[model samples]
Target: MPSPPYPVNADGCHPDKGWTQRQAAAWLVQEESPTGEVGFVRSTAGFNGPLCEPLTVQVQFWRLTYRSAAGAQARGSTGSAPDYSFTMAAMKHVQLRVDGRRDVVVTPPKGYYSSHPSPCVGGLVAFYTGGPLTEKELPSRIVSGDSLLTFDSADFHTNRVIDSKLSSPSDPAVCDADGKPTRPTSAPSFPAGALLPTPSYPPIRLNPTHT
Candidate 1:
């Protein structure tokens, strides 16, 4: 929402993408009712320390109209249709603020009518700012902590938990590279070069269910 020093000349008139040098100078100088009129100034300096050129604002009015159905008689008349309409008054004004200070009043020229309500019922006041000001103008960031209490604890516990009682020793389980059992493997094997134990069988018994 940043704005240039002056209103942009959409027709490629201003070279700096801002106010032209002449426009800036005119804004700096304050003038009375140059045409010997009153109510608003013709031109003035803007809040951004630049000139604001004179501008004309237009207002309009409207009314609602109604028509009866074709060939329909009027509500209280014989064989005649009736039409109705109503008028509403609305107004709009275009003005400039100088350096965000002072409201100069100007009188509209002949043909300007205030009694007839304008169709556009609102006022427009434009001011210049470097850009839209933000209430909270800061960037955001996030910080995180390590999951492990210590590097050694993470390294040792991770391997031990993986090797416990669920994997083969040769398959990266139960021991480190030197084949020492720092953790228990799912199945125990005879030590390297050691004889296998004699095989023994256990008795099995079934328990009755009491559902």
Candidate 2:
């Protein structure tokens, strides 16, 4: 699998505590694609598990897939970008993917809010306010590597903002449901969102069809 666009710490925390708000603002500025190219960024989240139950978690996944007003003029396509936002109120987990190769996880600080910057000209933003989740709480598909998609490094660059509130670096150990530390035998698997609903545009396959 390809590495995430953002910097991931040993604890599987993207951005960790070193990333700052200023960095996030700067990253929000989209970079122009050379060949009128396009790419995508993704964010996933899960809920209704052991941590927070009874009530489902509400989430908003945003995507920008077209050229901005100014961007369209420069491209000479006379086309403006469209905003793609998906809201999931009740689900075990949700995975949002764009039309590119880069997969990103939007992780904020322990007590602060954070967003992920998209690698493509028009990117995706992930935002959610809920209790921190554990690996077991993540969707079964992601844990089993059924929905985890990998793409080429050159295809996308997932730029994410880091939280500056952290005083010390994060611990490398992956935490369990009870808040205990557990070392992984291999590379740690970050949290992933579940499948997306069918949209008007072409849908990216989250799970591979079995033969």
Candidate 3:
């Protein structure tokens, strides 16, 4: 099984330790979804690099706590239970290279833990690229035909097929026509129009090694 970047607590809970600015930035990149489009108003305020860049990362652990009795029992509770939870780990910063793009060399960070991820680890790593526009913004692309690799691990290798991809906001201007102030619409929450497609590529495996 794969190991976590830092040892988890005895209760299998990830420590709530704070992360460095770079670490947090790396995590944000890893955490963003690989599908859909972000229409305009962007977050991830401080990062200024292109949407996609090589990532140096480590494994992170997460816990899912059941908030209701139905939720607890659905996971196979033996008896009536007020609450329940489960824990698992996932590797982040798994890099995906696009077709025809030049290769990138990403040095692994300290506390490197390389292994085939545990089967229990869930979700696809985020593949970042410039959103609909070229401004500094979060990744808004999907993994549709690229090769996913693991640079954080000691031995770099490749995973051939990405079985699945994991599957969010904004504001408006105050200007009006003819230099007249416009009134806000009474129904602020309406269905949005058809959206343009974000960049997409193929995927790879669970435990990535550099090829």
Off by over 4 Å in 3: 1-19, 22-47, 50-55, 59-82, 85-211
Candidate lDDT values, in order: 0.24, 0.23, 0.23
TM-score of each: 0.16, 0.17, 0.17
- Cα RMSD (Å) per model? 41.1, 22.4, 21.4
Model 2: lDDT to the true structure: 0.23
The model with the greater TM-score, 1 or 2, is 2
Best by lDDT: 1
lDDT tens per residue, model 1, 1-211: 6764544344422233354434433443333333222232332233232222332222111111111122222333232222211111111122333332344544432322223322211111112222211212111110111124211010111111111010011212223223344455444343232211113311111111111
Instruction: Give candidate 2 regions above 4 Å deviation.
Output: 1-55, 70-120, 129-197, 200-211
Model 3, CA-based lDDT = 0.23
| Candidate 3 lDDT over residue span 30-55, tens digit each | 22222321111122322222223333
Q: How close is candidate 3 to the true structure, as a TM-score?
A: 0.17
Show pairs that collide, candidate 2: 19-162, 44-193, 94-193, 94-194, 95-193, 95-194
